[model samples]
Target: MPIDGLLLNKLIREAQIFEGEKIRNIYQPVNDEVLLQLQSGFLLFVLKNPSYLIKLESKPNMPDTPQNFSMFLRKKIKNAKIIKIEQLGLDRIGYIELSVIDETFELRNYKLYFELMGRNSNILLIDEENKIMDALKKGVSPKRSIMPGAKYIPFYKREYINILENENLYDLNQPFMGFSKISKNLFYEYIEKYDYISFVSEFLDNLNVYTFEYNGKKEILAFKPVNFKYDEFQNPSEGLLNFFELQSMNSRFLELKKRLEKTVIKEIEKYERLYKKLKNEEKEIREIPDLEKKGRLLQAYLYQFKEKTDFVVVEDWETGEKIKINLNPLKTPNENLQVIFKKVHKLKSKEIHLKERIKITKKMIDYLYQLWQSIDFVEDIETLMEIKEEMIQEKILQDKTKNKRRKRSNSKPYEFEFNGFKIFVGKNNIQNDKITREADREDIWMHAQGIPGAHVIIKTNKKEVPMEVLLFGAKLAAKYSKGRYSSKVSIDYTMKKYVWKPKGSKPGMVLYNNFKTLYVEPI
Candidate 1:
């Protein structure tokens, strides 16, 4: 419903007058409005910093201090005691007398000569000098117009009320024919101040008393005022009682107003928390590319090492036979190390992704709680469904349809040929298992000591293995292990017969004796 001027006037008429009330507190919720708590037994709210409007409502207790708009009112009208008040213009305007110090001042006046022009809505307070003491709202300072220092001429004309003083009871049943307007429009224009139900009730009563009819049917039958005895209307229909109940129920709409206010507060808190979490996660995700670049450099280094052309020395364990195996860089140490580090980087990226997912989950929890509190009907299940869809879109809730079956590709164990001998290095778990169980007893096995690293082996086919190739394989072992970045890593080498895996040892873990420790830093 539109808040008409008449309704505001009616409210002012009903407000209790405070003759000697003091301005105890004031609050300014916005630039254009002020709420004043007076020492009088009323809570007064003054609106329109641009136009003059004062509203008063009763409260059980007065506030100790001003809040929001009340603070501004105290500053403007300090220590002024109210003396007298007069209602004018059908209670629309109120003029007040005040006693300030020893001077009897008549300061408070509500008949503001105000104008709302486009974006410039201003309320000018003009004194006898035609000088504006202050304005509730400010307009643009024009070069040619009266401003802060200039003489004030009325910027706009004031509205005057014209009352129909001659109309009497006889005029009420004349179908308002003098206006030459539609009956509905005329009735509305005359009785528009009342609410819809009240207007309908009053109009019907007038029709019944006047024997007025529309299309040969009576529109109104009876009138029922707030204090009317409903039981006296014998044989009342259910329809009439239901209509009365609807009107009565509307008086309690203030409960819904309170619920709306509480919902707004909860939504504000939820949004703030979600925004903070997303901001932090965004910062973390931005660092992932840099880590990926580091992984690329490490992969390139291992690739180059595996591409060296040499004969790998291999030692047969059972027959003590040694032979030379030619090494192919693409299928040897370079390829194996590249694959191992790639898996490591992938695992690290997954960890970061999981962390981000957890953050989103927490935000969703807050959002759901807020949603539940704000909405009235649980039957509208679409809101919950929308939240689920959002989670899936953000990848917080994984989409099973997007999970593709991946074929596992195996990288053969690391091996290279140097000086007519065979050598082998294990890159990862599956490859380590294969290399350890398949190598001959005569082959020399090597691994980083007391560290979880790659397995290295040198084949001796009845020919003694070269020390340089053995050292190179040992260094490659250390480079691929958990201690790859350490200053010096220990690598033990022995015949394949001496190196053995226990029943269920983790890949690349083996027990060995008759081994030599080689301390090497991987190039």
Candidate 2:
């Protein structure tokens, strides 16, 4: 649930119990979470995240490791005594005053500010003069900036108010808070019934904390949500922790998955464009045959042609047909024929090279397509990371961050058993390379022909591979390819010996001959 002004007021009230406690230690378990261990049992929890921010009783597992910011906090005021805790009206601004004994035995006052302002929440350590010493998140904008050594500016929406001003219903509630929309709507009724300040205080004190499921989303509320039966939690913090965990698990993974997909799709588009260019260039090469015929005809009629400075009338020796041939005017009859012949030879030369180019380009497109297909089959974060690592290793993805935590996992193929025959399907290009090269020569290698797909190997162990096993392998290949949703897919299979990788070929590119094709509906 969104931590509106009302929730922050409640949390601030809970945090006041730690006012006299001595700060024993500080820890940053995660990048966005902060823990303060007090001499009293009451630990001060401050969470500063783009997602949500709240002050609560933290029951988080402390990491054995600590971040640099955590260590800085430990050194600054390890044994500092908390003098006071205050909530600045209903602006979602909070402050914790600390008294630290200086080196010379003089006492110094410092303040830690918690601005739980929705997605822009921040925590700042400040001196008596409000000069920022440090911040969990240092935000810089055209109008404001939070930087170390700079005088801190208190974040306020409207001109600073001396007291609660009833300019509007919202303005009145802004100094206090409402637990629900219904409660907020009743603000006018309460205002007429009792004094404004007393009514607000009563509302905050009367809120009952509980946990409930609403619209299939786990929510922790200070009041029982209106229409749904809820599981009651004596401790609001524990329920909120569970809700945050369950909510963020799917969200974080899905966010990473989308980023990975964007990277893959960008690369696939490039390869696809190259494939079309190569195909178009190969089409242009077809005109070479007609050009060659014209050159041959000119060669036969070289002596018969009378060069008219710009054009020549030539006779086809085979058909005795008269034809007009445009000449260079600056070259002899033999030189003219040689010029046209050279042009035809050049295009013909390109034909052989282009055929090889078209082959490789098609393979590259297929390789990228297979990589795209594998993303949907990734069951865990581990598998997704493996695919990302493969792309990075291939120089297809450039790491933008200096601090990328890479967990190296080996290329592991999907293993299956069909009729006692072990079948392995490569999930990505790296795995495809491994599966093909490591398999026995006689192992049946299957792939969706002319489609971007996985490489499937049936481990026959030199035994007579059954027809049923081949069909199974074909289906596996199709199921892992771009044609998985198609009505029919053609799969090709042959011995591993036929699938040979040439030097300088792309990771999953291979040449295969003597392969038979089989039609199968992708499973």
Candidate 3:
């Protein structure tokens, strides 16, 4: 969870670190993480993709030299003393005003505004006249120009319910004292028990870190605890950092997943469009049979037409139909007959070829759809990377941003163990090809029948697996196939000796003959 407005307000209100401390230095460790060394304590600011985070942390080690934003902040407020810190009403914006003496011996005030809105969060340094000195995210948009020397624009102008006022809770679009939606119930409970001012003051003074952990799952919250037993930490910073790490991992995973989804979806659409065009072209070749009949008639009557002719009349022996055929004026009747035979042969060949082309295109569409399903069902980043690499190998995914060659990710097959027998599952085509080629001939191979998906193998060590382990492997095969969400999926299993990758064939495309099919619902 994010640090909400109420928790932030409470954190700042109770923190004694800012009372009279002077800013000694500032450092930007990465694009999103920042460190502020004050006279008495260290403050860490993480303003990555998820709004912004502020915590009184230990002095972190700087990884590199300061960047442009850090340099600008150091130049302006390096040695300035903190005069006041305040939150803008009940909004998520906070202000840290500084007092600095100019080179000419005059004291000046600079305001550093911290806006914690999701995705749109920004930090701006404003002068006394409200002109922006610099912004964390500098850009010019229709609504505002976030750059140096532009007038600072406040986040919003809506009327917010003051926590201390006698306001109706139902009319509020947001929490009166908190930022996240999770704080709503707690706020109502507090309001029911005590007056607004007393409740907020008490809540702020007694802030604690609450973490819920069950069955290897974990989540951290700022204050309110649920019915399930949880861990309470006296230090909120530790809780905040723990939660931040989890959120950062989730954010990165989501980013990669979205990019992969877009790539696969676009590829699927391309193949579908091709399939439609080919189907239409196949319609034009439907007259091949009639053309063949005409060619045979002209050949049968070739000797009778000894002179040149503009047209020919022939009678079909089977249907007793008279057909008038147009011919080239400059050519003899035999020449016209030869031309008709050649045309018939060409059309016959082309029709056969076009039908095959349509079949191949349709098959490609099915494979791309299966790949789409595989990507949608995967949850691991390693699996996604492997799938992306397979696409790159097949020329399905093109990276427009890459100008130089980069090394591939070090991903391998997913490993599982059941009944002391090792089970391996391929995450993508590349892994599937590798596993099938390198495994022992006696090992068992498993895959979803009639679907594109990961290949599962059980290491037999020259020993046959029992029904229990075989069923488990089949379950995994179905779970990773195109029928992952469907019931009664058929899975095929056989020894490694029965499965073979054809020479010069595409990756993950294999041939198998001695396989047994089993039906089961995927786990």
TM-score for all models, in order of appearance: 0.33, 0.58, 0.68
Which scores better on lDDT, 1 or 2? 2
Where does candidate 2 have its weakest 10-residue lDDT segment?
A: 175-184
Report the lDDT tens digits of candidate 1 across residue range 50-122: 1233434444344565453244335445565655453344223344444444234555432223332323444
Per-residue lDDT for 1-523 in model 2, tens only? Answer: 5655555555565666778889888887677767787765445444544233334444467788888877877877788999998876666677889999866788889998877765577778899887999988886887778999988887865443322444355464453332345435444455656656865455466434556665676666554444557765444445555667767776766777788788879988988888788788777688777667778877766667655466777676668888777778887777877888887777777888888887777776666766777776666665677888877876878866549776587747899998989999987777888999999999999988887788899999889988888888888899998888998999999999899998877667677999999999887
The per-model lDDT (C-alpha) reads 0.48, 0.73, 0.76
Cα displacement (Å) at residue 195, model 3: 14
Which wins on lDDT, candidate 2 or candidate 3?
Answer: 3
Model 1: residues with Cα > 4 Å off, grouped in runs: 19-31, 36-39, 46-76, 79-99, 102-130, 141-161, 164-336, 339-523
Error of 1 at 104 (Å): 12
Best by lDDT: 3
| Best-first order by TM-score | 3, 2, 1
- State the local distance difference test value for candidate 3: 0.76
Number of the top candidate by TM-score?
3
Q: Rank the candidates by lDDT, best first.
A: 3, 2, 1
